[model samples]
Target chain A: MTILLHQNLERAAQALPEQTAFVCGRDRLTWRQLDEQSTAFAVALQHAGVTPGDHVAICADLSLPAVIAIYGCLKAGAVYVPVDHSSSDQRLCALIEECDATVLVITALSLNTRHTLETHAPSLRLVVSGENQPEQRSRLEVVCFSGFLAASGRDPFVRPATTPRQPAYVIFTSGSTGRPKGIVHTHQSAGQYAELTATAYRLSSADMVAGVCPLHFDMSTFALFASVHAAARTVLIPAPVLRFPASFALQLEQHRVSVLYCVPYLLIQLLERGVLDQRLLDSLRWIVFAGETFPLRSLQDLRSRLCHVAFSNAYGPAETNVCCVRHFVPWQECAEPDRSEIPIGRPWGDGLCRVVDADDVVVEPGEAGELLVSSGTVMSHYLGHSADDQPTFCFCPATGRRFYRTGDVVRQNADGELVFVGRQDRQVKVRGHRVELDAVENAMTRFPGVLEASVSCVPADGSQQLHAVYTSVDRQALDAPLQRWLQSELPRWAVPSVIQRVPTFARTTSGKIDHRRQGQQMAAELTTHNKKES
Target chain B: MIDQSSFSRTEATRQILQFLHEELLNGSGPVTLQADTDLLASGTVDSLGVMRLVAFLEAAFAVTIAHEDVTMENFLNASAIAALICERQEGAL
Candidate 1:
């Protein structure tokens, strides 16, 4: 029984040992090599005092070694926590401390942050460097990855017995409370997600999947777990290559990538700037977009261009790993001309979905309500929260199941497909990553000079961008320092693009800052400014 | 015709590095960037940074960089960017 996530890697290695499993730039790891290295690394982790249920943080870019470290953590029965290596030192330290990670697998790019981690994360004892052995200066024991793996014998490490309910991994997402919340997924939940994704896409060993999203993003699960489940080759697109659309498209063509699961933002970039007319991308068979809504016009344009490729819209929050998917039939889309937004489709596999009103009563067909999902793919719970403390899940009396509140308002169309209306909360998707407006506002207020902050999401270039209007005494002097502070506190996607200093904010009748009016005024000003520039 | 004598390769490379350090990086980039520094692989430049660099290059060097020209070959390093600028200027002339 392949209950654990790493079992897929072992099975793939046994079936297709010599096949290329992962490719990143010039580095490629065969299935056998990946399996063997991961097994050895698992033993190494055990020797380094990593016990079952311990959190192992991996602060590295998506590379062959990082992938191996992830599987190694899983094999060792330790929950793997992937941290964005590009994030500021402060954010990295906060995540490390929050997760109470005992061991850190870091790459050379982020090696300098070890000093900060040593001071901030007291639970961290061992540091496994992906590069050459750095001189140990801190209390944490540092070991080179190559040396550590070599010390462990060439034999496979004996697997530890673990229940399906045990935590497999923890993915941190933007929390409305200003702290990034860790969403804990059990072995059963993650494994089910991998199995469902492979089955849904009909992924095979012949398919070359493009791993475009970073490891920290939930969308990366499609590239990591799904590809492993089907024994498919995953080409990890480098961060730099992802920046240039032409280069990104070239990678797709060069690798003959058949399946690509990414956000709408990247697809829009490829359509506008990728110069796809010059490249032959017939190898692309399926393109699945999730995390945010794709603009219909851009989607239509892309469909027109890649007539052979199938497009799917996947829907689910991080709490539920892609419970629903809509595969667009080219003819059907053409038949329905008036359809403005793509439906999120029906629940897949054993997943159950309910749309309910404020009273928790199920809404009638075609009525808009908050989406509730119950499935094997649903996460166990947040890391710091107990089952009782979590307000995200509610019990459904009819199904006798706990359903996760998605906070997304959706309405059922005539075809029985759920169409996304809008977010019921202050959370918005920026470049497909969730950003809570309240969180950004809170971070801005943390700055010494800022008195009040209000953040708004504005649609720009097919994706959403954050804009902040704040009241500060030192308006001119605060701009650079405030930006620097926010960049250090939050992820790049969460940072506001425009920060305007306002004398006073528009207030509601209750004396609370009216965010809607402020947002409208900003949007109006932006539109007028853009028109004048053009 | 553009005056080729006004700008040398070294001067162009210096200006590219300066722009990268001041504008794209916002003083958060590496302390020193060599001519052969691998910008893309090192995570020195991101996607949005590349767009800004392209615009800066076009406006500063008086060269129009096509969309297809923004590949790793030309933008991989300061030297490569300078070379692309010189090539564009020569092509225009």
Candidate 2:
């Protein structure tokens, strides 16, 4: 019972050596091929001086090489930190520095990124995984994918000494105080969640899983690890295709994908577009949605359309990959009447869920309170956090177990299922990515001439849209320059839809930024502006 | 080809640029949306941003972009996006 994540890949390769392991676009790799290539890549990483406990940054899209790089980094006993390949070079460089990455595994698609990193983090070793090789650059050691594989030779398997307690990965998420918080997870903890996911989804070797989420997202763990654990074939849908439901549905049909893991926003987009039809999704058996709350109407519409497919709504913070899962039973089967909202379900695996009051006392069942999760899957700590900022986990003297405050509002129903209320903090999900409204505002204030700023997620055309309102001394500075600056500082999704300039931001009685009242004022302003144009 | 003249590259670029400036770029930056502005490579619009842009184009141009049409090569920049719209409009007409 080895808990190392790569051991599953090794066993799967040994058992089903010729089985199709991964399909990225037109490229397909067998279990043995993936194992051999990753082993070779791991050997190359060691030869290139990546030691155990070293951080390897993987900044690439959903490609075959990206998958191999993840496994290779794990096999090499290094932490695999995935950053979005589409991020600005500045953002990518920030993450690379924040994670203290010594090696970066990137693809040919991001050649510009390689150059940027070379200029910024000059000491980094770059391994290019694509068709064409990049030209030699000064102060940087570059290795071509084909050449590295060839040079490493066959069966040069070098498995560095690793322990279950060692950090396996570091995923950066939005922080309330402005900076991106890196959540570190140990090998055992991450592997525990992966195994739990595979069993919970009832995945098997015959299942073809469609990974719609990006590697940078926490949900992509199923795409990378659970499939390998189950010896199931994982298919990564391209970023562009994911936008078009008709195209995504066609891919599902063509591949006979059995399990789908994506955010509810995507599902809602597909349903809203009216392109998610039966023929396109005839092969799908399980529809797993997470990262945000699922709208009731969208869920009902999907269940009505795909009656045979099972719908499972998952809930958890990036701290604990996925702690709670609620399977939607049919309306007729439930004892209680159907409600407008969906319950986040009971805790999965060894997770313990509790709703606590302000005094840290557990609330009575059916009462709304802040949810806390106690599990082995909780993140080790926030990267680079001081002793005061660390310890999101609290030890329960009564139970002698650690509990991480989820900061999510939830309540248990009569059936003992935890129903999601709203977020207790200013954090909101923009297309499944966690965003701290204050962080966006912080970035906004940093722009020259900006006096004060606030951001809110407003409902627009049946979708959550980010709207920003700011007061600036220089009215001219409220436009394009501010946006370009925010775009550089934040991810693309964090960029506000409409950035408006105001004389002053409304405040609360306590003189704090009255987010709720400001949101209403901004909504009214937008309506008035719309009316004037019409 | 009958409606190709109906969708001029300059007009298409102007409208798309306006949409990017307002909806995507928030009209606060020094972003110059030229014909060759490399939207995909420069991260001007991400994958999610592209989806919103597609919806905007489909509505503004009255041209239905197929699922296959949402590629980085086809929607890479103002010129490529306008070219896609004109080609689709011509075919539709």
Candidate 3:
């Protein structure tokens, strides 16, 4: 018997119907309400012509309705693609078109982008507003969410027969190419990840997990699926509260959140500005950080302050959801301020990993090379791309397993733990979000009058920031418009912070753009400028 | 005196709204922001935008905003920001 993601919800509903399942701001949903509402939503989607395996793109923030919509899509046997609600219209339209999404579960707050969606997403036939009733005037059929559910009647929805091998969801991430690549995960893969994570964290019904990451981010799967697997409560932190660390701490304390899975940058913010001394977050049992390396000094400070919590450094690309995790109790390990890197640890639960050279040959035990992951949690394939794509995956003949090529370069230490070295590509993590420099340059070149664009990563204030130098005919006139255009094209973290117009880019002997030289120059100039200002 | 303070707050609110619209938002945001709009809740301003807004207010109003004072209550909206600025100015005087 195969178990699907929504089956966890059903089991929990039967076992703990009155227990709170999800909480977002002032809204709360018990297991029974969540189950019934999601069932109603499933019926609504079916009535609205959403067939099994159809793509239903959810464009809403972390809210109760969005949670309901996710479960609803799963119950209806439709693939739920979570889109960043704050993304620009052009990006949203591109995703909707790429997935050929027939239905969109959107919040009222994002209705402003409807016009663009109507024009661009031709396959989008139905729009279900999560909030207020929209006055529909578009070619696409729009319905109020509440009304849609009410109209579906009380008839029990027949669960669609779905295999574990069927695609459960598609998450889009920054690609080396100009466009975003959608990573598709089957129900088996995602369900295996949820079970592994729940077992690793020792989650139970008494635990309250903090849903910190946005739905679009891959890390959000842990909070969303793992909690359901354990029948635990999930407190979806609102975006606004996240901006103020003090407020975020209040939310954690108020909810007595037991487990938090977020990026290191957010945890750093909580340490610096969260007023942790005032809040008694004694309920917090585990703090898992991933997506980027945590600065050792800050990690020490955070550990010192929150002495009771166990810290884990989780590592995996979006292709493989948390294949490796290093767990450490602060007091157990020696605090070495000089240590710069933390080990990403061994593969989790039957997962296989190996470091391979450029020729796909396995490297020596201590040698640094690109890491490959073969795990049940691994994504099936990137949407619209062949599974045999060399850059994405490599076949291990020795083990007869397909492994994801995690562009990350790592070395195995004496303890058989993987230590991060550097990237084998131009991909960099900016505030825990992946940004491909090539993609940023491509977006800049899309602007009118821009001839060429070169983006460089500059270390600023303990984190990496992107700086771009573009060649344009009209440098002075193109500044504001180019900035606006880039804002509309890329995610906020991917957009370059400092953009300068240059006559020409420095080139290497091979005629390619010299990014290393440009990055060094920009860093030097910024340092001098800061010094002069001070 | 009360009228003068209220007038100054209104003026400050206008200037802040203009700055948010032109600088932070870049006129591409989903909703048009009013003085009383919940900038945080509405997603009009993000974490980076909040930092930039604080810097802009410090320079524009000639008031220093302490790190501890950068709470949601003091920066929830244009009106709230103006009130924080006014209070800081009064304290300085």
Candidate 4:
């Protein structure tokens, strides 16, 4: 499969010669067309001295040609690093320098961030699309994806040779201090994850997926890579559609999209907008939501709203492409409060899950502990400066095998289902009392029509106080129902002192709920309101 | 837009106040309305504010702030803020 990541297109192009593999805004490309276009781009990249294992940085949003560039690098035996097109210039340049990439492929949308990179990164090479700034283009060797496609690659396809140990792709996730962390993956490891996961989802070429998430996000990797490897068609949703719910749903139906992969926020918005109906989504299957835990109320709203499709929970970090997933079969069955709770479910495809305490001792069943995952899907580690480059091996102490430390706090129920506790750092100590924010969130989600809820502890005057942010299908109308529900079940301290609802929660690149912003908003709102009254 | 008052762009303290008044604009927050004294590191101004202030000075002075301009000398308190803006504006004009 490592060999095929570069060479797989060769066989796929042969087997499905004229079959449509990708559709971009009324333009459909067959396997033959995709293969030819990508090969031509790779040959151009190779000619520009992008040799085997050379890092090729991609600076573009989701598009057919951009997608081709990602795989083309691998095909030409080089690793691809994707930078978020919307990221700040300072942030983008930091990542480019850290990856030490010598070549960059960019689109018109990504050109603004280039003002900081042009004169710097002396070894950087370029391939531009749409329009070129000739003065800027001369700073680096620039060629367009279209221009490259028109160029000749006369020879038949010869797959570039790369060892299993070779670098495949580098995705930069957010750092604690707003810096970027470069997460590197190998073709051998990412391929195993992609293939097994495709089988788990029962994907085939018959499917046409709507690619909503950016390639820069790890959660989007499943859609981007899996569809290519499984020979399914994909359409990049336009930016406007991505921002608004109704437009996004309309685009899916208009494109005849059969698979939907997005964050819970996007899914919740689709349900709120109610653009999807039986006719619109009949062909759609395998709706995977990850990036953050789903509010049970929103999950139920989706089940009741769209009763036909399959909804699945996808859980993982950039370190491992995908670690675990569970099907929300008979999703209506899970609509009941006790039925579909926040169980991240078990590990995916031969992966092992362990709940261990601070002492590294496996906790008794149902006890909360940090989750340690050991799997073939485990990451090698952070690049060059990594103190330990060796992968964290998943081990069963009883059986004596190495394992991966997931750093996730999880507990196994009697049925061996894993329920995510909040992060280890978020555990609350109030008057030396322990509180799980998820527990508070669980109680609040029970409120009728309350789609999502996030709880955080922040200093009010001197000590920490519980604060909750939520959204309802009915806007601020759900406030009364939420207050009624929490009044019955929660203690005074446990109940969020302030429940602020928003149009949407600010999410990080990987899709985790951004509590820091909520906390800031809380402080800002308090000061604003207090001053207004005074 | 800033409500202009009689102040020298060369004075570090006044320039800091101008940068704060421009970037923050007293938008429904008491903290912004309260003090112009300790704007830096008071959580009143953040990393984003620093970036915007740099850009604001570039247009206000018509001068380029180098990548090396991120040091505390140009960024500490309002005095530092005013000093950087004034230095750039004085030379720029």
Question: Which of candidates 1 and 2 is the stronger one according to TM-score?
Answer: 1
DockQ of 4: 0.02
Candidate 4's displacement at residue B11, Å, is 45
Alpha carbon lDDT of each predicted model: 0.84, 0.78, 0.84, 0.69
By DockQ thresholds, what CAPRI class is model 2? incorrect
* Model 4 misplacement above 4 A: A1-3, A109-112, A135-138, A151-159, A331-337, A385-401, A509-512, A527-534, B1-93
lDDT string, candidate 3, A433-493, tens digits: 9777866776676575665577888999898999998765434457778888889888999
Each prediction's interface RMSD? 5.4, 6.6, 5.5, 17.9
Candidate closest to the true structure, highest DockQ: 1
Worst 10 residues of 2 chain A by lDDT: A503-512
Q: Per-prediction TM-score, please? A: 0.83, 0.76, 0.81, 0.79
Worst 10 residues of 3 chain A by lDDT: A503-512
Candidate 2 clashing pairs, residues 3+ apart or interchain: A479-B27, A479-B28, A480-B27, A480-B28, A480-B29, A481-B28, A481-B29
RMSD after CA superposition, every candidate: 10.4, 10.7, 10.4, 12.4
Query: How high a TM-score does candidate 1 get?
Result: 0.83
| TM-score top scorer | 1
Candidate 4, B18-50: lDDT as tens digits: 557655555432344332354442444543454
Q: How many residue-pair clashes does candidate 2 contain? A: 7
How many residue pairs collide in each prediction? 0, 7, 0, 13
Better of 2 and 3 by DockQ: 3
Docking class of 3: acceptable
